[model samples]
Target: MDDEILIVDDEHETACHVREGWKVLIVDDEPEVHRITKMTLAQFIFDARPIEFLHAYTGDEAIAIMANESDIALILLDVVMETDNAGLNVVKHVRDVLQNPHVRIVLRTGQPGQAPEDDVVANYDINDYKDKTELTSQKLRTLIRASLRSYRDIRTLEHHRRGLEKVIAASKGIFEKQALKQFAEGTLEQLSALLALEESSLYTLRHNAYELRNSTLETLLSNTVLLVGDDKANPSDVVLEAMRQRQNLYRDNELVIFCNNPRHSLIFHIEGTRPLSQMDTYLLNLFTENIIIALENIRLNELLADNQREIIYRIGEIVETRSKESGLHVKRVALYCELFAKLLGLSDEKAELLKRASPLHDIGKIGIPDAVLHKPGKLDADEWEIMKTHAQIGYDMLSGSDIELFQVASQIALNHHEKWDGSGYPQGLRERNIPLEGRITALVDVFDALGSDRCYKRAWPLDKILTLIREEKGRHFDPDLVDLMLANLEHFLAIRDTYRDEFQGE
Candidate 1:
């Protein structure tokens, strides 16, 4: 398996990542067995590296070792140590309890009568079984090599699966325009890691090659990075030359990759001391191809998200306006939700999603009659009941959409009204049953709502608002979140101040 590495391109680092010795665990009770096994394999090497040895004397000890050691390639086990079927139980623990199916287990027994070879092989998921007497030096060596090869292949596939999963998780949010620069930076770091290369950069310039109509290209042309030596730069020359020749460049210690979409072209210049191998070249080609596609997707998705955001604000404003509220209330609420998410340590993608989706939290309020919504006095019991239905109404309007934003928005609209305690309306879900996004919106929305002017109630003073929040901890608000709000109260207040309603000063 290629060790999880960034696409870096230096010989020394590449060698270092893959050169570590394979780990082997020796499990037996006898001191001589451990001594002889180590001596036998003292000079043995595979794939240009020696073996790392670990010893465990009992089934309990082996199980302990297996618990802590994830990368052990092989276990040479003795069947009748401590108990008659101790090795069998160790195998069960390794395979069943630990759920580690990758390590190769070889069962060696001193007494053939204690564990019949056929029975041991059939019952246990062991790769090999042999009577201790039958293992000559050559035979033992052969078994070790075969087992190690199988372990290597299995681990390689497992590592690749994990690598792909991690890539997907990280890149799933890459289409967000704000993430384009971040994605490029990560790719450069990963590329450096994958090839063991050093620090590098990716720059994108768009142009119609034949005409060179864009005026900005002139300044960009001068300061472009050079691949080798004195660091003058060539984001322009390399791209233009490669475009002119219509091929990627392959010179000694330098590589110029040229890729283009119909609208524009992308070129990269990298300097490496090691010459490119066919595998290295292939990986680079695949990476660049995917990166070009990602850059294009970000462009398209950014446009779509911007439009969605505008519609959301407009929708939120229409609802608020009918209730005699400022449109900037929605804006303030959005910013507050984002700030709360940030303080909670939500990922940038999740926090950004929350910011975008939060404006629609009250979209269901659009369905409420204006008389109840805009009433200048406290709501009657019947009117309060009617007002409470907006949560479910908003959810109904937004739920069942395949779009990710709408799905998140739907949950927020539905659950934000549900309080930290069971006293909340609609479904009466209490505590953590409420989704985190809902909890976040509920807190920030209340913070904004209490601090802002409403036709029914004047905006409360800062001290009064905080007093209520502090009193509501574990009642109306999540205790931890309330604590977080208190801890970063200044920043939250700053966000509110920044996006405060225009009428607030009056």
Candidate 2:
């Protein structure tokens, strides 16, 4: 079965990029200073990008603009404004208060005495200090270029820092997911985040593990490998070549990453606007290493769950065999419990738990004396009392285990015989007092048991069995469960037909 990519967002999100142009904020009280600075950089285009100018007359205004805009690349500030030390204070706001270490601040003052150049430079975190007299067009352009270049380098470092953080966080998150598909989808999503991807990029999984049908991801998180770039170029040949070679392949706008293990072979097809840079490659590799390990962990969990299911059924069969009942009884009961649980609107997780635990409802019968257990006739009052002790015995045997499966089994074991009206059971837990797991198991077990041949009695006709169940509603059985069972009788019958017991007589 293909898994749906419900945890995955269909939209492709790109990494952060530089805005329209490098932002240059001019913080000076003199209107002429702003004009001259703008004129000085009117023909300026650094690294083939233009400057976007922002002006603030007062230190307060500079702080306000800085507070609103986190991506202002450079600030050309004046030392004195509303307050004599306003520009210095703006530097404080940008550094200590805003904690914005990336934006480059160059202090330019008309009266350097208000805040001396050497003193201000040493005490404050300004990149450069320029007196008003040093206003040559060439010098100013060179200054602007130097500041913007520094800003770009810092932004790159910040981007990488954020990227690494995402990888670390994503690794932790994927490990916590027990389901294979969820983990895979999460991996694909994280992969998409590593590059500036196109909206056309698709994520799919190999080995049919994840099937992302532009809609659902089958395996590998989805059977979808994200193919990025111009949609016209088919990377099928490249993908096949990588698979054969068992090596990672990178083309102009495509990436074929091959990961092979003894259990499975997965090829990740990633596409982007341009060829992957060394940094992008490094991040993806790191992400892949974490994902492969998480995949192994999920596989182990799956194997363990399979083994547990086998052990439970085998144990239940052993107990049933002692009472001369067919093993199919446990299977039917498990399926019925799952069905009933689902119909009751229990989640998939809860429904699955009930199914796995219901088989052991009669596990306590293992401790019962064989003479009463396998008897060909009904037991007398004393013998019946001895037979009834199996419920508590089963609960006691399973309750001590720390495992969740057994914990639930203990509940089912203890309360499966409890009647709705407190008329039956070891503890006579009445009505809703019985755990829902116990109640669901009780209804389904009796329903299957009555329809099947027991050692002491022949299988009753369907009509008789259902009549007894309907009559006992609100008494022996939960009225609501009984109603649901009757309503979905055909589905129940289908389940019975699917797991047929050969001992069921004509």
Candidate 3:
């Protein structure tokens, strides 16, 4: 018989022992019967594992052992121990009370007439009923071997069932992940659960092809380690060689899986002491195939979102350029809005939304006539009134779109000009009545407009802009926001300097 099972890869091999031992519990009142059973099976080995014997002298003792020990694969239960139906009661407890249907139970009775084979087989959940006198050494060994095989098969099926459920749950989790790092971490978590290992592993991505070529195997592994927790182990020589050759490596205590994509490659290193069965290998392969698909989908979604954001920035630039303002005006304002939103305790998602939507704050100016938009001087009262209508026009153009980005853009376009004191805009909305998105954009827009040179006005000095912002706090901007901007004045100045206009040279 093969002492080890090897999961093979092309030109590379990884092997694991089947497992250690089969735990067999012997329940009986007679010391002689326990002695005889142990002697009979002294040299017995099944499935490449020796037998470990657990003895219980009474039915209660057997129940206690069964309750405490989960790995007992077979029970040689004796009928009429301490009670007439003591062994039968132990079977009932194992099957019904403990709900442990996995352990195989065989009833051995010296008093065959008391518990007949036909009655015992029909009534009790015992695997086999044998008269103690007929159970010789060889017959007992044969019976134990058969019972162990059954136990092994049942445990394998149970493992696969649990593994499938984990795969299903993991698929849902991976699908919900939006970022690459989140997806990779989630994959590591789920893979650990699938293999019944502790969450002490690492995941890595290798992007540079040249690095893979120039670096030694150990150096490559060390450089690409992205997520590592408490449980860390060095990759074995077999594992490193498998990775170098781009193949899966599975050993008794560790597994390394590789996923290749056109843009990059991912490696997952998992460690545990349990040997994986053939079925485990199959299930792991299936789970990894699904994970690769999910990872690719998340990558594609990220690319799509980047494209959409770029298109929005370009559209905002066109509107700004039409009004004779530099496209950099919107870029600076967007960064300012993002920083302000974050300092105000907005979540990462909301801050990103604000960054993407702030550029469209002046999108309404696209609808204004060129004469008013490019006036080169302060707008006359009548012309200013017409230009103000652009806010409502931009809102109408963006509203009613199903896209979430456009919906937020619409709110910023309409309400960014509204005042905290209800004195400004097409809507004259007062303090808190205005959406928070509009409020943030409003402050950032004014800050950028004051510091930037535009068609109508020269850029103000930093000190003059700060004084005006402080003076108009409650009248033009949210009091809290004005305080926050002043507190983090350097951050806004940094953004202004980074995306400065062509005339604002380094």
Candidate 4:
């Protein structure tokens, strides 16, 4: 980056040969000073570009103009404007109070007696001090070029610092959606301040036409984006228009929002009063695109969570159908698993996953023959052996899935039938070797199975089932899980009784 050119010589002809290539602010009390400065630089265009001149007759007026326009690359301040030290005051205000460090300040005094070069240099933050009498045409152009070079350097450093902060904020927000709104607001605020724009940019987030949100208010602390005013116009609608038009209105311009949707868009104006620059447009487009990607990621995460729950519910139904029990059997098993997991002090996430996976404990029955699955009489050794394969079948059915619920479901299917005493099925795995989810589901499955009447069996009394589970502790079930279930026996029974399907018979 190069510095913005500024010519501070009070002499008009001395500033000639400088043209269109840079943004300059010429501050002189005399009107002739302004005219001579413009005429001399008129024929000499810098890089074939036109010059932008800001004129101020007094230091106070210059300060006010600079307040509104911080993009002034260079200031051609005259030491004597309204007061003997008027130019010096402007420099103090720019550097000390307003802190416009990016704008290069050059102190040019017509009468050196008013402000000495030594005092100005030591006491003030002016980048350069020059006496109007000493400045030649060559020196004037050289001063402008040097000042612009410095200005460009400072602006680049400032931009890099702000960009790093934005990336950090954005990364934090990516993992925590709650933090995203604030991050977005901070990014917008930094960009606005850096660019020295007039209007504070606004952000609106919309989902389909039903919900319109503003990023500032809703996103930071609430669920949606915070809108500035209520105009009843859909934000998403505006975004669609901008997208359809393929214009920079949504991409690079200020006063125009780059909208990804009607409900969500960033509304901001360019830093200066000037129209948006090509660079400004390009940067804003990049910003909007990044935000859109973040929003999409949030939406996708929510969808995946919902899908996980739905899959669990479907698997529960499949398990219940095979056992000749009402479908509610699956629901009861899930509730019991949740309660037991909580009793065991598992985290909410783990508990929920267990609840969803618990019902698939017998999912291997999906592979069992109806003769064995709905047998009216006790199975012979051959039939019994075939029945046990249901556990392995359940494990096989659910294995190799990337989804969390299915992964746990696979473990439960493989281990749920294994007895605590190492006397049960395919692997004969015992004790803590059984997955916690499998242990938790095993007890709940039995409780529901025993409490409910199957095609070939009658429903046992709650008291009887409770006694049976207590007696089998450490023999058929993991004792710790059994204790947890026992403590919540009534809660389990209530769920069992509630989900019992209405059985119709001939």
Candidate 5:
């Protein structure tokens, strides 16, 4: 309502009388125009704000003044100032060049013939055309009111359009579940700008406590935001209910919870004595709807990942069942892989993934015929070849998977039999060429094989098993990893003891 209006006329007393409760800008060829517009509008108050009269003597002066204060809602333009078409040119500047669309322009000319109504209306952007002589005081007031109302509506629409754009832009960043924090921060920034309120005065309704978002507002308001809670020790049930009900309660300055994270969310408070507006409610709901959906998607994605891990564990158990090996052998190997991954300096996430994936290193054995897998003696050539097919079988089972863990597991299953010296099966990938995961699993698998009694072979003594690993060195094992196994031989022995086959006594 404090937004200004402009009046342009040659008569000083008349201009002053017209400039009442509105802030006014006067533009005319005669200096007296400024004085009258101000005097006429002095007594009238539109919305609690008295008219501020800004004076301009000619068309050129009016354009310059308008450029500086483009927010002027209404402009009473004089047509016969300096040139007959001068007012028309100013209208063009305001609409086309300056691009100030919200201000309402009314054309007023002393000489009707010099700038005819028909011609001016057709060519110019002015809202209304009038002759100065026809303007009575009551008629002038009516014109001012109409122009101001149009200006107000236009401004409101503009503010709204900009706010929606901000919301849409912020929503784009909410593609992933974890990105809720980023989206909330962006939504808050745009909302604060659109509402024309101090950012601190805005409070978002979240779980329990309304947390202070803006740094400046947090200190200024002393962290006392809207609270529906019982006591200030922590957020209470009443406070939670108030937020869930979308009720705005301003009793004392206690923070409110607004934006929630995966578990806890961020709450920001807008500090001001003025109550929340309809626009405030509208914007807050818009942001909340977007954030809630984003958080939900994140949780859903995590659940799916966990389900996938469980499936892989089950698949590994199936492979173990194919041989005389205990199902827990797969689980024990998975744990050993994790320990080895950590010793090899893998990140926690990568180590965990390897732990889940490494158990499937023998997954192809599920495809091998039971006669060859559960054979009571060393395999003949044909049976050995059939046994070797397990590697390819395992590879085929896990290949072409979109999942990263399964993809790596497939490669390990295909190549774990290959020796470090390039003398092993399937592809015979040597030393450094072998997938590191396959290499690590090979060591663990062999150690487990030799330390435990298999249906085809007796469990060797720990000393003898260590000597076999030492003998294999670069020829059968990656020497560096071989050293690691030697150092952790007791740990490997312990795993064998822990998940030892129950049927070994038979």
Candidate 6:
């Protein structure tokens, strides 16, 4: 039957280029069958695409080809090859061993008795079974078109499923990101996952929309091109031209996405060897839209946080001024707390939290009467005992709030005066019993208080303050924190100099 087939004209067979086409693998032991099949489909075009035929004469050869090529859309398998069950074995290998459920397989058999149609369809994972005699030129074309359609639809669904999974995974902790650069980098990582591109891409953020210089874009272009070694010093003329016209560019293998707001303009540059499909472009657009909204929310939340910090500091300042201490005391303590938290190996988020919360440590002093708070002479035992109530009072004022910063501040207020050896303050928390935030704020507050002038005492010399701190370690302060402060004494001194009070003299 195969010998009865006529060869296609050379002019028709070699006319069109097979650069872009659905990959079709033909597996049959008979060389004549392979040649006749190619000739019959020489002029066939499905969905505006030509067929790129890969010939594999045996089941083993077909397995090798499938192993190497991932984009094979359809396999035309002959049931009787080297062995009667060769085609059936290949089906098992592709579906079970390779775990490739996307590629469609159609079994063509010269002898239907060897592998019954109903039994093969019911027992194996083959998509369709056909007799060789019934597969004429027209039947072959129809069969291929149906198989390719199924394969294309399956691949499209699989691609979208994978892209959605990546989007969900990448967006996990993005909303909690406090810094713009961190959020931007994380957004880029998610973009990479969405597009299946490499993570090493250049991102440019232009604060001034009017200052879109070619130099900035050129730097990004150079970095991206260099990463892929694309041999171009500048971006493609299309990309440059698109930027000049203020339009987005999506090439087969490159993408330039722009996001703009009143305050900032964000540009993403990604390049790869394969062009993005329409689905990829759609997913990227959706991801970027969500990113813009997320970024706006993050910025607003950051602004709110800044305002809250300022309010807390101002309230602390009012308390300090009433107690005859400089407002700079709170500011310096905040900076010192941040530094100590970092030195103690806390994460950036936790360090910033401590910075914002430490300034309220003396807020309890608001409850102390003016006579004791403003007394110039040494406080008598009664006045001292009355003054100690401020810690409990401050904690009472700020506690019971669901806000995380306030909760932290309440802890600092309650325990900052407590001694490490159970000898100080309202609670007398000893050693590790004190909250870590309290332990940190206690050391910074005392350091700044000793160095700055107050109503009761003149500013002590740096050497005298250090001697006192060293002598009192493990008795008044956490021993490890005291050692850490001493080790990084120069940094603390820098913070003191940076936030010096205008009223240094008593």
Estimated TM-score for each candidate: 0.54, 0.81, 0.84, 0.50, 0.62, 0.79
Q: Which candidate, 1 or 4, has the higher lDDT?
A: 1
lDDT by residue for model 3 (365-411), tens: 88898998877679989998999998899899899799888899999
- Candidate 2 has its poorest 10 consecutive residues by lDDT at 1-10
lDDT of 2: 0.78
Off by over 4 Å in 6: 2-4, 9-23, 27-31, 38-71, 79-99, 111-129, 138-142, 197-248, 251-253, 262-264, 455-457, 504-506
- Top candidate (TM-score): 3
Over 1-506, each residue of candidate 1 has an lDDT whose tens digit, in order, gives 11211122222112323356779999999877787777767656776667899999999999999999988999999999999989999999999999999999999888889999888888899999977777666667778889998997886676555445444543444433346446545544444444432112223222111212222454546543332223433344555666567557655545666655543344555655665544445556655666667767765667778899999999999888887777888898888888888887888888889999999999999899888887878999999999999999999999989988999999999999888887887788899998998888888888888888765567889999899999999998899999998998898888777876645432
lDDT (tens digit, per residue) of candidate 4 on 1-506: 01122343343333434443456888998887677666545544443344577889899999999889867888988988788888888888898899777788888777787787888899988888987765655576777767877876777666656655554454445435423344345444544533432223323322221123444432422333334333354444344454345333633333343434433444432223444544445555555565566656655654666676677667667767767666777888888888887877887778877887776787888888998887888999999999999989988888988877788889989998888898888899889887777777778888888877665567788789878998999998999878777777777778776778554552
Q: Please write out the lDDT profile of model 2 over residues 1-506, one tens digit for every residue.
A: 01221122222223344336778999999997887777657656766677899999999999999999988999999988888989999999999999999899999887888888879888999899988777566567778888988998887777678778878987888788777556655665567666643212334322112222332122323344433333343337666566557567776667765654544455667655556666667677777788778878877887888899989999999998887778989999999999998899998778888899999999999889989887767899999999999999999999999999999999999999999999888998899998999888888888888888764568779999999999999998889999999999999999988986665444
Model 4 residue runs over 4 Å out of place are 1-172, 175-295, 301-312, 342-348, 400-404, 453-459, 488-498, 503-506
> How much does each candidate deviate from the true structure in C-alpha RMSD?
14.2, 10.6, 7.2, 12.3, 9.4, 5.8
Candidate achieving the largest lDDT:
3
Of candidates 3 and 2, the better by lDDT: 3
**Tens-digit lDDT string for candidate 5 (81-148):** 87777888889998999998888888877788998889888988889998777665556667776777
After the best TM-score superposition of candidate 1, give how far the Cα of residue 375 lies from its true spot, in angstroms: 2.0
Candidate 1: segments with Cα more than 4 A from true spot: 1-178, 193-251, 256-269, 276-287, 453-458, 504-506
Off by over 4 Å in 5: 1-24, 43-55, 64-70, 134-138, 178-276, 299-303, 321-362, 371-391, 400-506
Give the per-residue lDDT digits (tens) of candidate 6, residues 234-286: 45565565555555668776776566554444555666656677877877776
Candidate 1 has its poorest 10 consecutive residues by lDDT at: 4-13
